[model samples]
Target chain A: MTTEPPPDAHAAFSAVALTAIDDVYRFARSLTRDEVDAEDVVQETYLRAFRSWHTFETGTDVRRWLFTIARNVFLRSREKGKREVTLDDDGAEIVDAALAREAWSRGGLDTILERADLGPAISTALAELPEPYRAVVVLVDLEDQSYESTAEVLEVPIGTVRSRLFRGRKLLQEKLMQHAIDSGLIPQPTAPVRSTE
Target chain B: MNHGHGSDDRTGAAAMDCAGAMDRLFDFLDGELGPETEVRIRQHLEKCGHCFDEAGFERRFLAAVQAARAAEVCPATLRARVRDALRHAGWTEAAGS
Candidate 1:
């Protein structure tokens, strides 16, 4: 026998949680990196959120709440170890920015960014990124969540979010550069470059 | 890391140079820094064309990534599936009733 949800609960769930289906689905897809697995995660997320609708405080950020639940569901489904990555990222930001500048100047990445239809390529690059960095980038850059909010969702400290976010951007930049070169969007380097520095 | 930008100690935006400004470019672009720091970086950018250009490239890159992902939405099938699951779990909202 099922205890039916009350009228208001149904209305509230529909209004708040259901409205964020797209955003939550995108976040789930970023985490799982597979459409089928992502759909499963989103389904479970909505069901769990609906079941616990009473616990959700009204007038808060619905998207953040749903994202928290979705992330947890994906993690549990994978049942992998903790995804925390230790960082010695003291100068990584400067180094990454400089290298990206080098790539941009060398490859005319400005043109690639402006004129190219990059949705598929960006998705592929993002899918290939490691989990920790991908999560931060998706939450902060794609989902437009702030660092503080992202930290809360990922259950990491604020510093971790910043470091991973920078590192993720760096990796994606490098990958996109290579993608451009491979796709003939940019010319191959005249000299076989050895070091990124 | 070090772009040879002396100590991290600086008085204000007046003392901030290209290296210091460039180092904090991501934080500035992300709007993650405090007001004073943000103002300092902005002030430096306003005066320094080189750092400003570098910041522009990075900013555009981030915007491109955001634009790429913005088009994706929850698929219709997943939406229907969730609606059905909700109904099964006592949601009581009939479809097209």
Candidate 2:
């Protein structure tokens, strides 16, 4: 005999979908960078997910599945010929920890914390990041998703997720540093400091 | 391979250097490292001031980004609208039940 899904399957799907709605919207907003566009993407994602609800595996992660659907929707609706960020060798460079330490010690962290009202600056900087890097950062950093989960959402390898996240974070740090210097919270370095060794 | 460094009295392993510790900082912070590697990094952080400061800075930076994202809340109207639309589309209730 053929078996059918539970009668409350729709209710269960609705509950889980609603729970992830805010997160779904946030991800869309980060990608679309426009309120209207983000909302439209979110609505489309939910509608699509609802129609294909039966295809979702029961025990798997619902949020990740939703994110995958949302990402696909965003890509399809995005304008054609949009400039895609090329992940090059330079973009995969490991962050310079020593340089970062030196910068931090040179009143960098102090200046950043002092300019604690950097919410708008941070938001704008995130929105301006290259799409690949931005998506990884939003999923991994903003939403606290694991690198593995983010990879599944973006349909890329875990290595790609790791590299994109590292580069994205470095870019954001640089942007925040620039904002601090522009706001007079930190002074620009005249010449690079030579390591004393 | 061991880095030929002195072992920490508490953790009984050679402390990781700035480069090694920094390389694993994100993984350590994200709880993705193995227990032994995590202990090594933790021991290094406890003994080294510079690496400690760097890790602290990264943690704060992540917190700042999270705070910025948290500031943007999904409007109640949008939530209600999505819910209403789902119900209207008969996605909330089984069809012809």
* Model 2 per-residue lDDT tens digits across residues B2-94: 222222224446667899899878777766566777888998999999999888888888888888876666788887777777766665454
Where model 2 places Cα greater than 4 Å from the true spot, the runs are: A1-7, A79-106, A114-116, A181-197, B1-14, B93-97
Best by DockQ: 1
- Cα lDDT tens digits for candidate 1, A1-197: 23455677888788778989998988998888889999999999988898888878999888889999998898788674365333336336534654655643534666788655777777777776666788889988888888888989989887788778877887777667667667777786564423332
Q: What are the Cα lDDT values of the candidates? A: 0.77, 0.72
Error of 1 at A121 (Å): 1.4
lDDT of candidate 2 vs native?
A: 0.72
Give lDDT tens digits, candidate 2, residues A28-138.
987787899888888888888877777888788888898999888887886532543455444444235324544644457445753458777787778766566788898
